[model samples]
Each structure stands twice: as C-alpha cells, then as structure tokens.
Target: MQTPDQIWNDADLPTRRLAGLALNPSAPQDVLLRLLADGPLAVRMVLCRDRILPDAVVDAVIEHPDTYTRSFFARNPHVDPAQRARLIDDPEWFVRAHLAEGPRMPSPARPKPLPDEAIVHMISTYEDENMGSLGFYQQISTGLRRSLHTHPVAKVRCWGVGRWSGLSADARAALLADPDADVRERAQRHERYEDPACMERELPARPCHGRTDILLNRALSRAVVDGVLTAPAREDERATIAANPSLPTDVVVLLAADPDPEVRRRIASRADLGPDERRGLAVDPDPKVRLAVSVHPELSEKERAAIDYEVPMDCGFTFRHAPEVPPAPEAVRRDALSAHPLLRRKAAGDHSLPPDLVARLAADEDLGVRVLLAQNHPHAPAPLLLRSFLEYTGRERAHLTTRPNFPTTGLAAFADHEDPEVRALVALDPETGPATVERLTRDPDPAVRAALARHPNLPPPRLAELLDDEELAHVAAANPAWDADTIRRLAAAPLDGRT
Candidate 1:
C-alpha cells in the first residue's frame, strides 16, 4: 500500500534522487551494479531498461529473480537482439511476451529480427498465456516469413495462416492437407475468406478496426468488392478497399477512375498498375495522388521525374523495415542522384550508403532529406546532427543529440541563441565555460535552467543553490560532480524501501 513518492522520500529526500543517479553517465560500475541488485523497483527500472549495461550487470539481469526485470531487457533497444533473445525460453510467460512485442521505439531504424531458430522455436512450442502478442510480434525477419509456410514444425507452419496472402498455392494446399488437425483447421479458416459468400457473411457492416482490417487486408472477392462499391456511403470506405491489394483488376480499374481523389491516391501506390494506369495516375488532378504514384515500384527514375509532385519541405518521412535483400548499390546511386527530391529522400533511407553519399545528402537542401540522413546514417557528421536537432521540431529531435559525432566541444557557440531550445543545447555541452553556464542558470526557459543545473561544470555555488530548489533538487543531486563522500553516502543508502 506504500505510495511510490512516499517510499522514495521516506528513505530520506536523497532517495528520491536514486532514479536520476542511475542515469548519471559518470556513475561508476560498482554503483550501477549495486543499484541493479538492491535498488528500489523504480531505480532498477531506469537502470535496466534505459541504457547499455556492462557485462556483469547484463549477466545479472539475464538471471534476475524479478520477472519484470527480465522483461525490461526483453524490450531494451540498446541491447543486441541476440542478447535479448536469451530470454525466449524464460521460465516466465510475461518475459517471453515482452520479447515477442519487439522494441518500444521501432522507427528511425528497427532492430534486427530475432534469430530464426528462436522465432521458430518460440512459435512451435511456447504457450502465449493468452497475451496474443505472438500474433502481433514485429521482430519477424523476411527470411523467416518466407520459410514459415514450410517450417518443419507444424505449429510454426500453422502460424503462417496469418500470412496466407503471401504463401504460394502449393504451400497453401500442403497446409490444407497437413497431418496436424489444428494446422488444417487454420488453413481452412484462411481459405474460407476466398469465398465471396463467407466474406459477405463475415463483413462488419460499419466502420471499425476489424472492418478496416478486412477491407485493407483479408481476402475480398470481386462480388463483395462490387457489392460494397455499389452500396458505399463514405469515400474512405471505398478508399479502404482501394488499397486492399486483393482487389480484383476490375476494381483497381474502377477505383482509379472513382470520383474521389483519396481513393485514387490509395490505388496509385499499388505495384501492379498496368503501364497506362501508372501513367494516368501520374498526372492525376490531386497532387497527393501524383506524389503517391511518383514512388510506385514500376516507375523508372525518368518516369517519376516527369510527375509534377511537390515535396513538402518540412514533412517528416516514415521508415520502412530493412528489406530482406538490400537494394543494390547502383540502384541506390540512381535514386540518390535522381532529379526528383522524393526519390532522393527515399535513397537517403538506405543505411549502407557509402560515406561520400552520406556527406552529400547531409547537406541536401530538403529538410526531410537532411533529417532522414541524420536519422539513418551511422556516419552522419556532427554538424548535420546538430543542425538537424536545431531545425527539426519532431518528436525524434532529441534522438539526434545521441547520434555518434554529435558535437560536444564546439556547441558552446550556441549559448546566446535566441531560441531557448537551441540555447539549452549549450547547457549540456562540456565545453561551455563557467560564465555562460552561470548566465544560463537564469535563462527564461525553465528547461534551459534545469538543463544547466545538471551540467557537471556548473559553478559549485550554483549547483548547491539548485540542489535545495525543490523543483531542481532531484536533477541537481543527480549531477556526477558531487565529491567522493556525497556519492558514497548516496550509493550506500539502504534501498530496501522500508520506512
């Protein structure tokens, strides 16, 4: 029944600082391991889930007695997937479920898929305890997906029912006749969607996630497509089916000329467009439609270049999963050098771009291109990372600061900038002098004030002043500049969480 704040504060006010202490970059190994082993759950939560751990601590977490502790690492993005997969056979179901859910942040770049053997083994024998996370698991690799329908294990094969649209006819038939009754039952269920009568009977009458799922994904026979199109109410309803991929060629032709521009936009991205359909959609009245068609797989660079698409200067780009087979270098060069900015933006996403190409795109005129390069390229120069951080206001902006080569010393130059967020960057730079650090202590923005409060180089008097400022106490105490005696006392505090 103890409150989290009460538990933290009753141990002494400094115990409330333990969460911040766990993230202190200069916190030593012995201190981190102690926090891991004996700290309160809140402290351990920060320690295990947020940063890379040393070998000894990783070993401890791998065998941690706490189920939540093990699961925390299951979704930790900083740890390698191979290390995270060590929990696939965990004694607890929640841990395995967490591993199945993949990383919390899947964009910028998703982590590598879990090992194929671990994936196959988990699906074959593990009971998901009704979490249903197994079905929505995102760590699946393309190679594993291709092999799913033929995996030696029947449960793994049965699991492929969800991917029925991608399976070969022979594979589907083999599944339909498999010795395992469950496998046959699943395959039959998927096969039933192919029947127009069943599709009609099961269709949810109104808009809902399930109806949208069926419209966009489940098999739709021409009869149902025609019936829905004939009886349709909203243009979005038609738009949903326009993107179904299972839509008949007739439906594709029908929707391409439909009264709604959104429907046309949805149809434009489909890869199967006949050459004429592709060309017509390219010049569609809707600029969004033309933009969608510009990147269709069938368009050559020259063909895409002719579209009058307007690339949004500040619009953010979404990242696709790393393709199973990487794009060839020559093809990437083609896109990177293409006249169209969208193609160049698409090429900016290839993580393996050679250094000269990364440097070239880093300075590209487009906001999305520079941000994409900063987000994906490991070798993105410090200046690009800094400039992207300054210019970009996306949720991913802070992630830019953590990139390799994000400048540390030279950022003191930004101290007096008009924008407080830009000025806040100077607060964290190790090279910012004591004078600027002192000046920033009173910056109009509380975020700037708090940021400089945590700088280890903040003048000792100011650091002490902020420590007792209730709003800044926890952050100030977290600073690694504290002398040896203070750190030892904070580290050695009994964290049993008993009053």
Candidate 2:
C-alpha cells in the first residue's frame, strides 16, 4: 500500500505508472512534477488530463508535442490566459477549434486580426466554401470588411460583400449595386443596403407588437426619462431603441411610463432597469405588468411584497423567484394561505417561506396543490415529502416523479409502484445496493434495466451478472472501466444467460 508520492519516487517504471493513476489534489507536487517530466509520455498525458494540477505544471505541458497532451491543456479549466493565447494559434486544428469554442478560454486582449497571409490564403483556397467562415455573415461583423474590398481576388471581393458590408457608406452603396448577383443577394437578405430609400425610413415613436410587447413598451416609458428619443426622427428613435439595449436610465424611465402595456412589460423584463423603474412597475395598473416586476431577480422582498396584491393567477412570473424571496411576515403568510389555490401553491415555493408554512401546505387536501407544494417546497421533511408523492395516482404519479429533486430515500418501497416513473427513479438512485440492482436487472421495463445498469454504484459482479442481457450489456460496455476481457466474455456469453 505505497502512497502515491512513494510510488512516484520509486525507481521502477511500473511504480511510476501506478503513481499516475493517483490524481487527487493531495498527491505531492513533486510527484506530479516527476510525472510531468520523466514519466512515460502516456503517463504525462494522464497527468495533463487533471484539471486541478498546479499552474506551473499545466503551463509546462501545454506545449507538449503530443496532440492529446496539448488538447488536455486546451480543455483544462485552470489553463491561464497566456496559455490560452498560445493554444489559440496551435498548429493542430482540433486544439485551435477547442480553444475557440471553449467558454473558459479568456477573450483575447486585442481581437486577433485575420493575418494578411492567412486572409490571402483563405481567399485563394476556401473563398467558395461558405459565407460563415469568411467571417462576414455573423453579427458584429469585423476583420473581413477591409480585405473583402481590395483583395487580389475578385471572387474574394464578391464573397466578402456576400458576407460583410464595408463600414463606409459609399463603399457599401457601391457594393450593394455590384454586378455580382451573390453580392447583391446577400446585401438584400440582411437589409444592409446603404440607400435610405431601400429600407423602412420611419418607425413609430413607441412601436408595440402583441400584448407582451405592449407591456414591455410601457415599462420602458417609465424607466427612461432623458433623450428618450435621440434619433434623427421619432420613428428612427424608436427603431434605434429597439435595436440597442444600452438606452440611458432617463430614456428607460420615460419608456417605462409609456401608455403601451407591452412597452412597460418589456422594460420590466430588462435586467438593466434600475430600482426606480422596478418600483414604478410594481404598482402598474395591469396585473401582468405588476407580476413581471414581482418576479424580477433584482426586486427586493419588500418590492415583491408590495406587489403581492396584484399577483396574476394565469402567469408563473410570481413563482419564478420563489427561490430568492425572503420569508413573508406571519400576517402576509396567513393572507397568502387564504388566497386562491394557485396563490397558495406559489407561496409554498418561496424558498424563504417558514418551514411550518410548507409543512402545513404539504397536508392540503387538494392533491394537485399538495403535489405542487411537495415538488416546489424546498424544506419539507424527507418522510412527509415521500408520503405526499406516494398519494398521487395515475398521471399524478408520473408528474410528481418528473421533478428534478424527487426524493430517493423511499424509492425501493415504490419499486413496484405501478408507475414506471417511480420504478425508474428507484433504479436510477446511486445509493441503490447491488442486490436492488440485481433485482432491477430483470425489471419488466427496459428503461428500468437501462437505468439500473447505468447506476455508478452498480457492483462489478452484478454488472457481470447482466453480461447476457443485451441492453444491460450495452450499458456495461459503455462504462469507462470495462476492459477488453470483460467485452470478450460478454460477447461470447449466450444472449439470455447470466454469468
């Protein structure tokens, strides 16, 4: 039972290889360093796979010549900004693509310019592939505008307009009327024409779409107050506002008070709206408008309480922030309890609600309301929570089991609960013993067996027992630890025979 560090320092290759398997954070730093340096390339590859490795170690292996080694660094969450920049230009396309697509890659300090040589090469070789790769069709088009106009290749110029319009109005207008049909078609498709007459010149001061739009428009009127309309014309102003989300606070305040309910609703939905705008919407005449404000993530509990009187039965907005709302005062809680069933259900979901209130709601006579409380209520005792779900029959049982955090404790008792969902949950529980998994391997439902087979805690012996079950065998084969011997044995076993 040598420790990982002891094994790492051992002179033998086998010991060094075994040390690579111990990747926990507590493994000695020198052990990791040794693995990074002198260990076999395969062992170094495994060490690089660990995301929690020290920064020094990660940096050292990031440039490792092995493609998989470099990829491991590219995908490592802890790879620093400097390493990301290096990987972005990696010779391997897969590594570069991985860096480009990974969310953890730090945004480049300066936009990487499409190099003249590369741009030329791309124009010569890949110009006809797709508009997407030329970097012009996507929103916030940049980097390709200049090259498209003056490239040595006309096809590249034509492809460029098909992808991006020049920033200069005159250049754009000329390109719009270019002889090439592809160029003209793309300009027309994205409405990038430079001529004012080609597009809608005037828009409403406050354009309202459907009912939802009207509420958003109203919220904007109240939130925006100054330079509320700053465009060349009022219509242009409205269009500009719609296009850009950076409207000034004064403008947002003015827009929040607009007569249109949709305008108000849109403003309420904006995460950028300030406290003043939110407070105003909370008291809006329209219940839907008030409901929008009530559920806003930034609205304080006091603001939420102030709008409680206007909660709408038809909308789920009030319940959206149930996880964040502070505990309502006793009087308010009682009022909420006495409200319509839907309102009671909404209140029960409030994570801040007193446990007693949730406990009381768990006992409500209406099964739907009780189920809602059980699923939404964050603090209900485990046993009571399980009992509440057990009471559901038919479709109700199916609905209850779909909740993401359905209780796992009483699952075995309900293994035979007529509903497949209940049995599926039981089989899926990681805590289910090998014996339970063995029993479930023969479950009448294929989904139940699949769930049991995939459980992380399924014993190797139990997994061996299912070698002959086709679906179960497939699941067992997919496990990372499934070795060549296991696969060969499973393949040779008779279809319905257990080992």
Residue 168 in candidate 2, Cα distance off native in Å: 39
- Per-model C-alpha lDDT, please? 0.77, 0.52
Q: What is candidate 2's lDDT per residue for 360-457, written digit by digit as tens?
A: 87777555556556555555556555665566543334444444556776466666768665677776455676677767767899888777766656
lDDT of 1: 0.77
Give the C-alpha lDDT of model 2: 0.52
Which 10-residue window of candidate 2 scores lowest in summed lDDT? 316-325
Point out where model 1 deviates above 4 Å. Answer: 1-12, 28-41, 52-126, 129-131, 134-136, 139-153, 160-174, 191-201, 233-235, 274-284, 294-308, 318-320, 328-331, 483-485, 492-499
What's the CA error at residue 498 for candidate 1, in Å?
A: 18
What are the runs in model 2 whose C-alpha is more than 4 Å off?
1-216, 219-332, 391-410, 428-436, 455-462, 465-470, 477-499
Backbone atom clashes (below 3 Å) for every candidate:
0, 44
The residue-by-residue lDDT of candidate 1 on 173-230, one tens digit each, is: 9999998898899999888877656777788877777777777777887767876788
Compared to the true structure, candidate 1 yields what TM-score? 0.79
